[model samples]
Target: MSSPVAMIPYTNMAPYRQLGAPRDCRFVPVVPRVSIGALLSGEVVAAAVPVGGLKALEGVVETVGRFGIAAEGECMSVLFFSCVPFEEMHFPRTIRVTGESASSVRLLYLLLGSIHGFNRLPHIAADGRVFDGELLIGDRALVKGQATAGEERHFITDLSQKWFDIHRLPFVFARWVVRKDAPGPIKSAISDWLDEFKAREASLVEQAVPEAARTLNLPPAAIRRYFQVIRRSLGERDVLGQQLFIRQFEERGRSLLFQPAP
Candidate 1:
């Protein structure tokens, strides 16, 4: 029989690679967007899907494990860099966002529409050069953020921090999701993989730094700090945070985007 296939994001591969690939599964590296599509298409039995993309999966997929990417506060990689101060960014609702993770895109919308009180959905700029505000995620966000520090007009806003400031809960970025009707063998394999990952969590972080630095083209120290700010394990509070996010998104009439897994 062929090994079950799993799609994992390039940005989130550090820890998984550190622990070595699962013997019973084929691990494929893909971006968050591709991962979601692959899962929906049945090309992969499981994927690490961005939280924002969950709504799209609706009744099709369900979370397989408690592990995911999250942040307690100030996730360094999911950032907003703007020419104007965050409070002053009112007149033009449009902003340029990196065409990467869907979760980051949704998070940006949630913040702008709910917290910032924008009357209209923000316009997403296709060209990066035309916007005063830009949303960046994953490795690109980290790299661009470093470059923006020297620019006096650029102001950085950490989205996770913004969410925490208001809700006091961690923001979950991605989670392991699989087709709801997947066979028992595939589900068992994924559960075992998560168990192995939890067992070597510390080593995963230590080994991930150098690899992540290479993949992100940032210094190892910087990658280390980024990892420190991220929470790979989901706790009770993290679950609450995700529920709050979904409830808030629904409240804003954007609930049609995702369906919670049964």
Candidate 2:
């Protein structure tokens, strides 16, 4: 029987997930956080876990390929929307995040606290109308970005763009990982399957555009442009960005992650 490999169902991951997997490994479509959980709990053999979520899974999973969801300056989906200026807003949403990704929420806290010197981070109520700021990722964020285009009421910030401005590296949101304890053959198969996935992505992405357009509820052109923004193959700079984000995750975000000022 083939091993199960997580396929994150996100617009940014349209290339990999839209295309069917190899015979040796089947694609299990799930969101990023769930993929991580499934991998750790032995539900799946491998997955593309978010970079921010990798801190706790240190030696449990092995990093597969350098390829993943990354971008140099702007990733259109992972956006932070604030009604007022960062300093003026009573508290831009931090803890409450789009369930699609927790790493995005963590990254927001890191940027806010580390660079902007914010101390107290507030948790947004589930399903509450966001008054301060809201962090949205994946397809929902892309939809929000499209809806707010040309509007100035919401202060929209691209997390990847912000990271690039601060660090000059491509922010790696997630990377491929496989079970370390899985038999050697399974590990090798996942790696080989990833390489094949990368090589075929360009054609697959084009094929996926129409489905993505309908699914994401965005114009085809917008979907096409977004694919250009999200780079699947990770380079050296992307690796550096992941390192910085993970390294600074705790050091700079200690205030928000650990104890919040009341």
Candidate 3:
């Protein structure tokens, strides 16, 4: 029989890698969307899928464990760089959504519409060159910083930070999931792996900092600070935060999305 496959984010897999790749499983590094596709196709038994895409996987997949990527206040990787301050911006603003993560895109919309009260929704710009604002995620966002050009600096808004400002709760970006019918052994393996990761979380971050800094072309101290904002465990507070987000999202007339599968 073929080994069960596990999908992890390409840029953020370092910490997982430090925990040591599971011996009996194959690890596939992919973006959040690709991971979702692989999970749907059964090509991968487990994945860390974007929270936005979780809506589509409601009955199809189950949470593997309490392992996920979330942010308490600031997440350096998901940012909005705008020519003007967000509060001063008006409706119909042209915004470039990153082609990276689905969850971040949805989170941006949720924030703008629900929290900021932009009822008309901003226009999504197809060309980055023409955009008044841009949503950037992952390494690209980290590298861009304030997204300065010559003497001009953009107004930078960290989405996670914004979420916290309104909700005072951690924002979950992605979560570990597995096919509902996955073998018991595979689930057990994943749970064990998460346990190991949680036990050695600090060491894992330390080991990954240098490589992450190199990859993102950032200082090691900055990288360490970035990791500090990321929340790995879905504890009570995190769960409450997620629920609050979902409620607010639904109140905005969005469809019912993401009930964790049993």
lDDT of 3 by residue, 18-113 (tens): 777555677776777677777888888888888767877888899866779898998888888888887754465677776668678778877777
Q: Which candidate number has the best lDDT?
A: 2
- Full-model lDDT, candidate 2: 0.77
Q: What is the C-alpha lDDT profile of model 1 across 68-169, one tens digit per residue?
A: 888989888889988887776554545776667777877877887665574544455554347668788877788888777768878999999999997899
Give candidate 2's error at residue 8 in angstroms. 1.1
TM per model?
Answer: 0.88, 0.89, 0.89
lDDT of 2 at 107: 79
* C-alpha positional error of residue 217 in candidate 2 after TM-score superposition, expressed in Å: 2.6
Q: Which residue pairs collide in model 3, if any? A: none
Best-to-worst order by TM-score is 2, 3, 1
TM-score of 2: 0.89
Regions more than 4 Å wrong, model 1: 4-6, 120-122, 126-129, 254-262
